[model samples]
Target: MHQTETSDDQNSRQAAKPPLRIIISRGSDASSFTVRPLMAALAAGTCMLVIGGYLAAAGYMMLREDNSDTSRLTQAAQTRFYEERIAKLRARVDEVTSRSLVAEQRYEKQIAALKKRQGEINARHSRVADVLARAAESGLTIAASDPLPVAKPRPALAFDATLAESTEATGGAMVPIDASVDMLGLRGSMGGVAKKADRRTPASPEKATISSEPTGASAGLRADSVIMSRIDSALDVMNRQSETALDLIAVAAERRIARIERVTSSLGLNLNVDGDGVGGPFVPLTSVSFDARLARAEKAVAKLSSLRDGVKSLPFGSPLEGAHDYSSTYGPRLDPFLRSPAMHTGLDFRAPIGTPVHATAAGTVVSAGRKGGYGLMVEIDHGDGVSTRFGHLSRIVATVGDRVDIGEVVGLVGNTGRSTGAHLHYETRLPSGTVDPELFLNAGEKLSGIL
Candidate 1:
C-alpha cells in the first residue's frame, strides 16, 4: 500500500510537472513572440523618431533660412536708405563749406577795408599835427564865436555799410538802418580841430576848464583839433589865393617879357648888361607903369611872407637907370630965326643932331614921320588917353609900332623944316585937349627931386 501510494504520488507529480513545464514553455514562447514584435516596433519607432527629428530640424532650418532672407532684405533696404542719407549729408556739407568759405572771404575784405580807413585816419592826423606846429610858430591868435544858429543835435544819418550789408544778401534792395553816429558831436569835433589848426583860441572871456565838460578829453582835444583844422584850412585857402595871384602875375610877367623880347629883336638896338644885372640893357617903356604897380604888389608879397615864411618873393629889381627925364618944353614964343610970334606946339633942348631922344614914360610909338611945320616928329601913345609928340628932330630914331623904354632914345634934336634952331619939341596932350607942358615938366622934376 505505501509503495502504491508513493508511485501514484510520483506519477502525479511527474505528470503535473510536464503540464506545468508545457504551460511555462507556451508562456515563454508567447512572451518571446510578444517581445519580438515589441522590439521591432521600438526599432521602427526609433527610426521614425530620427527621421521626424531630421524633418523637424529641416523645417526649422527652412524657417531660419526664411528669417535670414527677410533679415538680409531688411539690412539691404537699411543700407540703401543710409547710403542715400549719407549722400544728402555730403551734399549739405559741401554747400555749407562753400558758404563758409565765401563768408571768410567777405570777412577778410571787410577787415582790409577797415585797415585802409584806419590808415587814412592816421594820415589825416599827421597832417593835423603839421598844421598845428605851424600855427604855434606865428604870434597870431584866432577867435571863436557862439555856436551856429542851427539845431542843437543834427539829424542822424543811417550807416551806409550796415544798410548795404543787410541788403547785400543775394538781393538788390534798399535796407533801412538805425545805427548812426553823433553827427553834431562829430561836426563840433571837426570844427574844433579846424579852429586849433588855424591857431584860433576861444573867444569867450572866461576859459572853460577841462572838468567843466563831461567829455573832457574829447571836448578839449576836439576843440583844439577844430582850431588846428580851421587854421590848416584857412592857410590852405590863403595859400591857394596867393598861388592864384602869383600865377596871374607870373603870366603877366611872361607876356611882358615876351613883348619886350619882340620889341628888342625888332629894333636895331644894342641890349647888354646894365646897373641891375645882365637881364636887359633897358626897361621897356610900357613896363615902367607896370613896374610901379609891381612895386605895390610887392608889398602884398611881403605881407604873405609875414603870415607864413614858406612863400618866396618874385624878382622885381630892373636894370634900367633912367625912368623919367625931360629935355625940352612947349610954348609959343619968338622964333630963333624968324624973330616973330609963332605957334610953337612943343619946346626944344640944345641937343646935338643925331643925339638920342629917350622916352619920358612907358608908351607905344604911334607915329614917326615928317610933320607940316616941325622936322621929323615922333608921337607916343601913353596909356590912359595921354599922348606925347616930339618934333624938330634931325632924324627919327624910333619907327611906328616901336616900343621904347624910359631911357631909350626915340629921336635926335635938330633944326630942320619950320625950326629956327636945333632942339627937341616935346608936347603932351590929354584926353580932353593939350595940357600945359610945364605941368609934366614939373612933375618929372618932382620925381627927379625925390630921387
Candidate 2:
C-alpha cells in the first residue's frame, strides 16, 4: 500500500511536469533520445534563439524608421532658417534704397531754391549797375577800384561712392544725376561780377573816389548777403539826397514868407495872429532827426500857402476891365470938382457914361449907398483889416453884404456927387490909415508874371 501510494505520487508529479524531446541524424543514421534534462535544455535554447531573431528583426526596422523621421525634421529646420535669413536681407536692401531716394529729392529741392535766389540777386545787380552808369553820364566821376581775386572753384558734392561700387559689385545697374556742379559754377560767376561792380562804385559825390581794394571773405559770401549790402548802401545815399532837397525847399519857403510878412506888416496886419483870415491846427516839432526836417518843411509850406491866400485878397489889380485914362491920381492932386489942391484919397479913371466898373480884389461889400462927396459908393472888407472903396457911379450894381470877387462889376462909371464927368474913383484903406492905390497897382503889375 505504501508503494502504491508512492508510485501514484510520482505519477502525479510527472503529469504536472512539461514534456521535452530531441532528435539527431548523421548521414542517414538516425538516433533518438528522450532525456528530460537535455530535451528541456534544447527546447529552451530553441525558444531563446527564435525570440532573439524576432527581436533583432524588429530592432532593425525601428532603427530605419527613426533615421528617416530625423532626416525630414533636420531638412525642414534648415529650410526655415534659410528662408528667414533671405527675408531679412531683402528688407534691409529696400530700406536703404528708400532712404537714398529721399535724400536725393531733398538735395534737388535745395538746388532749385538756391538757383531762384541767385536770379533775384542778378536782377538787383543789374539795376544798381544801370544807376551807376546814369550817374557817370551826368558828370559824376567814378573811380575804378582794385579787382577782386578769383577763387579756385570748389568740387561739387558727389553721390555715395561706396553705394555705387556695391551696386556694381552686385551686378546691378545705376544711373547718377549730377547738377550741383553747374549750379555752383553759375553762383561763383555772378559773385565775381558783383564784386567787380562794388569796387567800381564811388564812395561819395564830394570825394568821387573809389577804393581799389580786393575783395576778401565778403566775395565768398552768399549772393543774397552781398545783395543786401548793396541795397543798404543805396538807401543810405538816397536818404542823404532827400535831406538836402528838404533843406533847399525850406530855405526858399522862408524867403517867400518873409516877403509876404513885410508887405502885410506895412498894412498894419500881423500874419502870426490867429485871425478869421488865417488859423488852423498847430503841429508841434517833436522829432529830432530826418522826420523833424520833414515836419519843418511841411509847416513852412503851410505858412506859404496861407500867405498866398492873404495876398490874393488884397486890392492889387485894375478896377476896369479895359484900359482907361486916369483922370486923377492918388495923394496930392487937383480935385476936378473943387478945382483946388486937395488930398486925393483915391485914383479916378475916365470912362464913357454907363461903362462897367469892377472890383480890384475879392471881398464882401460893407456899404453901397450915396455918401458925402461920393455918390453910389461901394465899400468892401477884404479880411485882415483891409478894405477898398469905389465911388461916383451912375448905377449901383452891387448891394451891401454881397460877396464880390476881383474884377467883378460893382457899378457903372458916371458923373455923380463931386465927379466932373463919366469917371470911377477907387481907394485902398487899412486899419491904420489910407494908402496910395498906385502902390498896390504897381506891385501887382510887377508880380503878374509870377502869379
Candidate 3:
C-alpha cells in the first residue's frame, strides 16, 4: 500500500511542471532571451520609424511647390512696372518735341517780317537821297539853327562763347538760339537820321512820335517798327514842304498875270476870262491836296509865260525908226493951221517930206488910202483891240490886208490934209479911246528886263 501511494504522488508532481520555451543567440557563450519577446519589441520599433519618414517626405514636397508659385508672381509684377514707366517717358518726349517745333515756326515768321520792313526802308532812303541831290544842284540853301549829332554805327551781335563752342562741336546741330541782340541801338541810329533830315527841312506840324519800347518776337522786328515810324514822319514833312513851294510859285505867277491884265484893260481885252461852256464829265471840285496844288501852280506858270509872249508882239515901241524932233505933244495944244487953242490928237514929229515911216510893231494893214481929213493914211490893226494910224501921209507903201513886221516901211511922212507943214502924225488908239503913244513907249522901256 505504501508503494502504491508513492507512485501516485510522483505522477501528480510530474503533471504540474511548466511547458518548453525556445531561445536564440548570435555567439556560443552569450546569454540569450526568449525569441518571442525579442520578436515582439522589434516589430513595434519598426512600425514607429516608418511613420516618421513618411511625414518628413510630405512636408518637403509642400515647401518646394510654394516657392515656385511665389517666384512666378514676382516676375509678372516686375514686367508690368517696366512697361508703364516706358509709356510715360515716351509721352513726355513727344510733348517737348511739339513745343520746340511751334517755337521754331514763330521765329521764322518774325524773321520774314523783319526782312520785308528792311526792304521798304531801303527804298524810301533812296528816294530821299535823290531829292537831296536835286536840291543841291538847284542851289537851294537849308538853314538849321541846331544841327543833329551824328550817331555811331551799331556793332554786330555777339553770341555766347559756350554756345558757339557747342555749336561747332556738334556741327551746328546743337546750337542754341539767342533772341537778344542790339536791335535797340540800330533803331537809335535810324532815329538820328530822321532828326538830321528834319533839321535840314523847314518846320512843319506833321511830326510823328517814335516809341523806344521793344516789340515782337525778335530784336530785328522791334528795330523795324522804329525805322518805319521815322520814315512816315519824313514823308509827312516832305508833303508839307512841297505844298509851300507850290504856293509860292503860284503867287509869283499871279503877280505876272495881274500886270499883263492891267495893260490889256485899256484896250478892251479881257484876259481874266474862264471857259464859256463846260464839256465832258463834270467832276465836283474837292479840296486840293499837295499833288493837285502843285499841278495847278504849274499850269498857271505856263499860262503866264504865254501871255508874256503875246505882250511882246504888241505895238508899244516908237513909231519912227530914225532920229526925229517932236513938234507937238499928244495932248491939247495950239494947232498951227487954226492958230487957236485946239486939241492935238496925235504926236507931231518933224521930218523931211517923203521920209520913210516904219511900223512900230507887228500888225496887218487895214486901210491904206485917202481919208476925209488926211490925204493919205496907213492904218495898222494890232492884236488885242489896238490900232495905229499914220495920218497926213505923203504916200502909202503898205496895201490893205498886208502883213507888216516891226520896223518895216509902211508910209511916207508929209504935210497932208489937216496939217500945216511937212511932219508925221502918229496916233495910238485903243478900243475905248485914243491914248498917248508916249505911255506905251514908257511901259515898254520899263518891262524890257522882265519880258
Q: How many residue pairs clash in each candidate?
A: 28, 2, 0
* lDDT value, residue 93 of candidate 2: 81
Which candidate wins on TM-score? Answer: 2
Task: Give the per-residue lDDT of model 1 (tens digit) for 420-447.
Answer: 4444566666667666555544333322
User: Each candidate's TM vs. the true structure?
Assistant: 0.29, 0.45, 0.41
Worst 10 residues of 1 by lDDT: 310-319
Stretches of candidate 2 exceeding 4 Å from the true structure: 1-226, 274-288, 322-325, 353-355, 445-451
Error of 1 at 133 (Å): 24
* Candidate 3 colliding pairs: none
Taken over the whole model, the C-alpha lDDT of each candidate is 0.46, 0.59, 0.57
Q: Provide the lowest-lDDT 10-residue window in model 3.
A: 193-202
Better of 2 and 3 by lDDT: 2
Considering every candidate listed, which one attains the maximal lDDT?
Answer: 2
TM-score, prediction 1: 0.29
lDDT of 3: 0.57
- Model 3 residue 196 CA deviation (Å) reads 60
Off by over 4 Å in 3: 1-249, 266-269, 275-289, 309-314, 321-325, 350-356, 372-375, 383-385, 393-395, 412-422, 431-433, 449-451
All-Cα superposition RMSD per candidate = 30.9, 33.7, 30.3
